[model samples]
Target: MIHSALEFLTQELNSFIKLKVGDPITNRVVLSSVTNEQGIAIPDQSLGLSLINIEEERTSKDQQNRFINAVGKVEKRNPDIQLNLYVLITANFQNRLPNNSSDDYVEGLKQLSYAVAFFQSKSVFTQENSPSLAGFDGDLKKIFVELYSYSFEQLYNFWSVVGAKYLPSVLYKVRTIRVQENAIQQSGDPIEKIYLESRHKP
Candidate 1:
């Protein structure tokens, strides 16, 4: 489920970028960490979508208990896991110009801005909104995307931990990814009826 959800998001974003930026940008968007094993740079002028954080939805914990089937049989099942994913999109642009670094910086920023705008315009993915996501075989019924804000200190710490220099980037929270297995652990017979009797002595 997680893989399908991420793939759907990446494909949607790539399509949007291509439509907005045209064919000039040859680099395709990728789902990867911002840094390599040797702490080197990512691909040039490519949008990197990295999963930075994951959190379970505590509000959905009510379904952890056993459920009763339609035939009144008691069935034990595992709790459904609902998750939220925090994805970071970074625009990695190359500084082809030897002396001037501002051009590269500007290009990266421009790509980031485009990404931000794209998400803002389409904050929700559903059957009506995104056909690709809707057609997915997994349990991805809907996805809500919103820009996640971080303090400057937190942002700096994140980049430092990721072992990468700061690049033009945006953080988005994808919400309500559900995972469930329908395996019944146990079952019990249904109660058919109750008997009552009253007696009086003369």
Candidate 2:
């Protein structure tokens, strides 16, 4: 489900970028880390989508009850695991512009702005909005996307840890991805009622 969700987001964003940029610029949107181990540039001017963090949704408990089988027995099942995924989308453009102009920097900022606007306009992704997610094997229902802000110190530390220089990027949190198998673990007979009887002697 996580993989499918991220893939769907990348595909949707790429489609939007293509429509906005036109044929002159090739579709460079990719699901890849902003930097490689060797500290080399990521080939071309591309928008990189990377999974930076994942956190379990801890506010709510998995309170789904056991399932009832055809024979009226209670079937024990594992609770669902809900998660939120944090993704970093970075625009990696060239550092130097031709003719000594700031075209490269400007382009990077522009791409980042477009990315933000794209999410702002449409933050919710569901079967109705994204058909690709709909085709997933009943794992995904809907995903809400929101911008996640980072403090300056946190951002600097993150970049240092990743061993990459800061680029024009945006952080987004994808909420409420559920993972459940619904497999019965154990079965037990249902208790119908409790009876209390007493005998009194005169």
Candidate 3:
């Protein structure tokens, strides 16, 4: 579910950028970390989308493990776990011009702005409108995206932890990625109906 949501956002945002900038040859958005495992920055001139953190959405959590299956039998299974993901989109444009005619840093800022505008216009995604959502036959329903801002100290700590210089980036909070297993723990017949009786005192 996490992979699907990330992929969907990356693709959709890339498409929007292409339409706006009229660039068909290059992908403006890509799923990549700010730096590789070797601590070397990737040299792609595209916006990199990386998962920064994942936290469970406990408010939407349910403890009920029993439900009626399709065969009209009560089945017990673990409840689904809802999650919120923090994804960071960074502009990784390089200064490719020999004569410095155009500044890639400024170009990166432009791309970053486009990313913000893209999500502002379409903040919600569903399987109905976005059928390309991988393996969203049921269970996974909707994905809500909202901008996540960080305070000065938090931002400073984050870049320090990442061990990289800051680039033009935006953070988003993606809501409710549900995870559940199909295995049933127990099964039983449901009560057909309840009957009420009147008692008379002697």
Q: Candidates' TM-scores? A: 0.84, 0.86, 0.88
Model 1 regions more than 4 Å off: 24-27, 68-74, 96-103, 192-202
All models: lDDT? Answer: 0.81, 0.82, 0.84
Better of 1 and 2 by lDDT: 2
Candidate 1 lDDT tens digits, 88-123: 998877686577663387877877787888888999
User: Tens-digit lDDT track for model 2 on 151-180?
Assistant: 999999999998877887889999989988
Q: Considering every candidate listed, which one attains the maximal TM-score?
A: 3
Which tens-of-lDDT digit does each residue in 1-202 have in candidate 3?
7877888788889889999889866777887777766762545567889998999999878999999988899998999889999999988766766556234888888989999999999898888877766453356689999999999898889888889877778899999888887689989999889999999999
Q: Which candidate do you rate higher for TM-score, 2 or 3?
A: 3
Query: lDDT order of candidates, best first?
Result: 3, 2, 1
Cα shift from native, residue 139, model 1 (Å) = 1.0
Candidate 3: which stretches are off by over 4 Å?
100-103, 134-138, 193-202
